[model samples]
Target: MLALYLLAGIAVCLYVYVLSLDGPESYYCRYDNQTHYNLARHFLDTSDWSALHTGSGAVADEAQTGYYPAAWHLLVALVASATGIDMPIVMNALNAMLSGVTYPLSSFVLMHALFPARRDALFFGAFTSVGFACLPWVLLLKGQLLANLLSFSLTPAAIALVIAYVHAGARRHWKGLALCSALSVGFFGVAHPNGLFTVLVFLAPFVIHRIADAITQSTWIGSRNPLRKPWVVWILGLAFAYLVWQAMLYAPPLQQVVLFNNTGNLNLSWAESAYAAAIISLYPEQPPQWALTLACAAGFVALVRQRRFWLGLPALYMLVVYGLCRCSDAPYTLRTFLAGFWYSDPYRVLCCAELFLIPIAALGLATIAAYAHRKIDRLSWKGSLALVAGVFALVNFFPFYQEPPEDQSSEVSGSHFVPTVGTAVGYMHYLMESGYDEGEEQVYSAEEQRFVRKVLEMIPGGALVINQPHDGSAFAYGLDGLNTYFRHIDTEGTTEQSRTIRDHLSDIATDSTVREAVRNSGAQYVLLLDQGLPYDEGRWLIQTGEDYEMGWEGLANLTDDTPGFETILADGDMRLYKITAEESAEDQ
Candidate 1:
């Protein structure tokens, strides 16, 4: 049964990978393309698997500074080492495989924990394996899928460990369970801080159950106990393990959480929860109608019976989602929801709760079956209801497909593609090959292409080239040069010298100081866009220009421009500036 489930899961993963590679529109190509490219480059160049450190790339100035957990990176690096394949392709394939492994493993563990006495664990496992929300995010190429997979796999094992400790009343089991819990929590924390939030929410019910057990201990004295009481030993073991783990694994990075908080606020909205719910339950395009109907029936049963015990997962999920959505004053929109999703996506938390619901829904259906059996013909009624549920579950799995939208252009750039999803597939291959085929090679545009050609002739390799009149030109021409001067000025450790350069550029159109600052900043050539004057404050310098003329206003005051700087080439709207000096005074 497990083998069958594994095979099915792998088949689905491969299908999704093929779909992802179809186009950049289906994946998050633009949103995270630069970051993923840089990270892959780092892994290939330095052989360092730690995502915590910044990559040595063009975007390092803007990249996140904290350490990312090593799990995904290690997998990607291992694959690269073995096959000598491109890091991007390897990472995508690995993610696809991981996604396949998680669904069945999670379902099996969950069934074992929830229905240990039932002989039909496999049946329940299959039901959960096909549920709508269990592994929905696996379609994407993001870290979230990996994080979700780890959490799902670890969560069930942790729950099973806890159940065993409670039922066996053994000190050894309690110790082992405590250790498992700590490790699970640690991995969830490092995988994504949001996983930590979900883990806490899941544990809340267990904590309450423990307290209640202690308070009602006397009431159970005369009863035959189905579960054991090794509470004292378990608590002590967990506490000791937590202390050691905190000091060794969590402390270093946690200490800097406060530092990250200020810059981390990407306000999210409540609408995301609603959007996710709609997609999961009622999307007209690809509705999981059977699953939705089953969930609705189960929810009705839970609500009518005031099943607080069974409500733990759903209730906790609602609380967390509501807290994230309502706590902030951010505008309520899909973009906001996606932005704040970096902290945690409520859609994901709801998916985890959905896993817990399969059993609840199955049990509800089973109860009805048993009732009909007693009322009518015992065997026949029970068999009929079971058959109905099985049919519904199968329906949820069989179609297993999604259609490409009719309007491809409209679909490509929007929220449709998530960054992780795009990178996992081969969408990036198109981008890298669309214009320039060689790394650091420049492709010339008619007017702007001329300027680029000239600049390349003048500027020395590794020189700090700044465009005085075009900010977006470098990307347009595939020039790999520093272009985020305004952003760099806002960086945490902005030197006074860098700040002076920024302030000068802010009003470059009217300020001679701006021109001198540009000259001082080591720009050898200036391309002035014809659409904007040299004094136009709106114009920002860049490596390419669609319609610009070369200027030498700032060059007259500089001594030895030949060795320190020179205009090496020029054509139409572009010009090349070269730095001749081995070391500038400012650099010294």
Candidate 2:
């Protein structure tokens, strides 16, 4: 039975990562995957396990200094080193395994801990873990939120450990459980602090109920010191977890990286209607998938009908936290502070909601199976097989969840989550669509990518290549280890010379100041996708309009006729220009 469950997990992983598993390139290159891949590549190239900087120059001079959690990238680097696999392949496989295999096992552990006797509920829940598209599919692909993905995988295990410790037999070895719980939470906090928040918010009611039970039991026994309870063990365990987080914060390798950033309130506030939409669908931009949505409703009904208040309380409390996190722009300072704990991020809160929903959906499945078993006693075995088939179909083929109704044109209503097509023909079509440059979703055309590869082959390994962040050149660093000037969309901490080159590179033919800036900046070449389409200005994802303002326009104006530039390569609108060292020196 366990082997069967493991196979199911593997199948789930294969479904999502089939493209990358068979190919050398990573999927979802249009988003942050490039930056993350670059970080891992840096670790691999330098062989420095302690280094956190990517040398992308998105932050400070000649290096990226803005604080980002890179432990996830470090792990990817280590795995690639140990396995002798390519970094992109390792990233895809590791993510696939984490989300597909470990996630289901963790869910099983949590469900088993919650309802020890209900094997039907736990088993059904584990099987359906892959079907929650809001998680492994939608959220994973949208921003390629790698760090958040790690934390999501670890959260259920942490929650399950806490449950085990609190409910352990009096004679059982709880010290070990406490230690494990602390480590689970400590690792979770270091991976992504939002995960620690998820555990605390989800389990707050559980601990309070335990303490209340202790008080009531003591009162019935006529104990005078009811408030002076013996629940100090749990409190101490939590304190130890906090200490672990603090120690990791100041550790030798991670001391320089600030875990939190003061992200100001900009598009963080969730309108009431948007919040309602998210709750109903549990997805970012689309309407609810009625199949899973109805199952979740059934799970809620089962909890209430079965009088499972212990499980119901925490599940309900998570929704309350989800609601509170939407108050990013509330007038009350305290309420806003509550929202800030989550960075007022909607996706993080949605992840928290899914943690509880998985088990509830499983309960719904279990309930349906039970009713079917009673109605068809002679065909119980056959019915069970049919139920499994239905689950597999729903996991991969349910198509009722479409883009928001055409009439709906709200800010949050645009489609962001693209579901994986189960059929080979459909998947092939999906790939074709993703590679089409005419669409706003794709970042580069096939010709542009080929041009970039040829340019990388021509340039020496260490030579600096100036690039517009919105164009295909932004991927050069990660794609072929090229030294690109712009690592991300923003020029947050770039040097003055790089800024000057960004804003005036087109004037290299006429402006001595621009030529001098280029010479001082040590730029050897410029790469451009002059006629390429940028991402949609109206989309809620990373806004590219700022990229234009930052300098893409200046870079786009370069041509073969430009005096100080020599066209080294050109494929359609994509061009690579070599800087004329003679002109640069004369200008100097």
Candidate 3:
């Protein structure tokens, strides 16, 4: 059974690798992926991983520095070192393969732990591992995909530890369970912050159970308790491990990374929860095939019937899902479900819950199958054969039918670029092979492409540049150049300082003070996108018309009118202005 499961995992990995090879076009514009890739490449080229600085000289603020754990970055750097492969490709491939294998491996572990009976475990693993809800998203969005893989992988391990510690008759087993739980939780936290969220949710029950056990055992272990008592050892080991992991989070570098650029806000809304649920439940182009859908339904029923404890996982997941969904009342608005919880984006959380639910759903299906086999002797062979056939067909065809939706216009323009992993790679390859001139103003398909080429050209000889719209632009362009500095200036006015500066400049309408500030920033170049004039202007005007209009005046000093500022390049509606003190100081 294990060998069969391993083979299934291998097949899934191959399928995902092929998907990763598809193209550069993704549902989301590969903005975050590019950001991580660029940063990783910069780290590799410069061998500096301490500061959360990008090529655009934009340093991460206190809260946002450690948003991504170091593991993914390290992997990218290692691949760059060993094979000289592009960091994007390497990282994408790794994420894809892991995503492909994760569902099956996780399901196998989960089912086996929950159902010690071999037949039950195998049945649940096969059925759940093939579900539509689990497969499609994991195989698509890179960030969510990678996060789900890590979360699923760690979830089973953690659950196993909880089971062993709580149920094992021996002290040694209990100690081992505690150690394993510590490692799993620590690793999960390090992979993705969302994984940490999932781990916390899973740990609630275990923590409660453990606390009860500890209280019960306290009297027994007071003075002359047996050293080998299961509960005593389990409690001590868990306590030690938990403290150790907690300390790791507080380590100097990790703490700095976590707390960097911290912004406290409640950004959730009730509307987002409904929208997310709708997206999960209905938005895909095609519904799951009957077989898999039925199987999942069955597994869900089985899980509900098998153990009361299993119900907690799904109930907690739903509560989180609903809570996160309710973070916003308006559709697509960024909001939070609870106070003090930073916006990790609950859409991704929905993805994680879906992952956990798959195995339970699978168990439900297997339970139905088990019942059928036991109830009738002659029908057993027919039922078993039908179930096996259904599993095979479902796994093979459900992912095909349940295709990811096309990238919405908002996703294209917004920070999230939604594209399949394959499409992204293909787009990159196309750009590289086409040898497209960076100086030309030809329209490019992907927004990042034009910006990436422009930045690449400006810094061809290791020159420094500053990028505006720091979210994607800073990360994407900084990868190509050495001394890139991100002015940390958000044209959209994301921060108070930026908003105040924008407002003051607009009020003053080309104030000398603002120009001086821009000049003094030591930025050699500035990049801006011309989003079809009136609309872009209108949006900015709405955000800060007076300040925005004023800031534009300072830009003249750095652009066509200012002697110090010269248009070095313009491509696909993006304008790059270079700063020079010698030419502009006197004029200013």
Candidate 4:
């Protein structure tokens, strides 16, 4: 029966993921995902595990895996290798399955930890898997927070061990529980260190409390504390072995990432930090609209009524993270030092907060129904709760469901693609208002894709290319797995690295600085898109042209006016150029 439920949940999540990819009406290419895909493709073709990225047509240790965790990339490569599926489809499929499988797995762990009755566990597990509130779907669709998804899915399992350890103490079977906890931490750390750290921030206190309680009990009861168990000797032995293994095998890569990613600058003011913290507290981005807010509040009340205080840990967890995020703003460096490695990224924190929030909010509704059943015997509370949850999901969320008409504002603007489901005149109208149809987007054309491929084919192998104009140009390098000015997009370090490269190119025509920068960065070629390509603050608009850009201002002129560049290819909207050796010479 659980297997059946798991399958159903997986099917629903996979369907939603497809919609997210197909119906965005915007480009769905994530820089990191595509880069990793390119890396994975290269990894399989060469059977080289030494490097996670290609440099000069071969795997190079300078791969970004040294910075970004390689576990997910490796997982993708393994799946692609085993299934013989195309890279993109494998990514979408595996990631969708990750979302799907996490739903059931999380529910099972949480329900078992919190509830006693098997039926209650199953029902709440299913509900948590498919939330009544649509927040998780919102996060999942963005589709870049794969590590957060994986970590939080393991969260319930980790917490379950905490509960078991606290209750079971030094029992023989509890040894298994400790082993499970260790494995959970190991996997969580490998999945994403930030996520593992996030989970630890929540769980560590509980673990300490459990140990303290056991020690207190031990004083009277002659060492009942699990820490005193003989198995602890084995645990220590195993931990030492693991540490030695890490020191021998994993230390260099981890050290490389930590050193590379140290972008030391403080930006958050106290007021700014507090405000950002408060906003993500209720929803990952902002407070959920009033209706969803009410649903969350009901769950809040239910948890409090039941004395399920463990659930409040997520709230506190977010608070600490947000505080640490801005700790760099504080004086004496002590706070920042102690806070060590808080990524200070509002959007990243928002993603993590949402993963922790949505499932608990779903369980919150279940708690309310269970509470209600005890109060009034007239209706089937469970049935009613499920029906309400189901209707809310299908109506408001199925595919970018609309916010309440009154709740609509700047936050729910075009970027969100939220429909107007609440304002529907009647039942049939609501049905008609389900959401946007799939494949209704106007993204880059197939001809544009083919054009990109043809250019890749024509460009000399092992020649590094600098994509001009900096708007969505990373796509080309990420697509082909070629070394370029930039590669990954998920990190601040990578962003700054890419920016520095582009800054040099910005001076290509008049300044030898661009040439020096290109040569210094080990790149040889630069691709210029036709001018007239539109840039709206941060994104590039796909446009058609005859040597005309997609409205990009700098692109077309740079190709024509830029000296010290040798044109290699001119096809439609794209042109390729090689930086001359004199271009690399320092200006006198």
TM-score of 4: 0.64
Per-candidate Cα lDDT values, in order, are: 0.44, 0.61, 0.47, 0.49
Looking at model 1, residue 498 earns an lDDT score of 41
Worst 10 residues of 4 by lDDT: 423-432
* Error in Å for residue 402 of model 2: 7.2
lDDT of 4 by residue, 258-348 (tens): 3332223234566655654443332222222333344556666766776554565565566555455554456533332323333443334
- Number of clashing residue pairs in every model? 30, 0, 69, 9
Of candidates 3 and 2, the better by TM-score:
2
Which candidate achieves the best TM-score against the true structure? 2
lDDT for each residue of candidate 2 in 194-222, tens digit (9 for 90 to 100): 77767876676567557656665664555
For model 3, residues 1-588, the per-residue Cα lDDT tens digits are: 566566665654454344434352222323343345555666686676643333422432222433345555656677777897665567656665555565466656666665676465465465456444434343244333443455555555566556656555536587676677678756665555546555555555555555555655576545555543555654675676557556654567454433432222113345543443433332222232345445555655665565345334543455454454444333322222221122333445445555556555555565666677777677764576467547644443333321134454323433122323222222322332232232322222345555666566655465545443322344444333434444333343243333433334222224455445444444456555542234333222112233433443332223345444567777654666665543444555
At residue 442, what lDDT does model 2 achieve?
Answer: 41
Candidate with more favorable, higher TM-score: 1 or 3? 3
Model 2 alpha-carbon drift over 4 Å, by segment? 16-26, 50-66, 169-174, 218-280, 284-287, 305-307, 320-338, 374-441, 508-516, 531-542, 546-554, 583-588
TM-scores for every predicted model: 0.57, 0.78, 0.64, 0.64
Which number leads on lDDT? 2
Q: What's the TM for model 3?
A: 0.64
The runs of at least 3 residues in candidate 1 whose Cα sits more than 4 Å from the true structure, single-residue gaps closed, are 15-18, 23-27, 30-37, 48-65, 119-122, 138-153, 210-290, 299-308, 311-316, 319-344, 362-386, 393-395, 398-588
Q: Is candidate 1 or candidate 2 better by lDDT?
A: 2
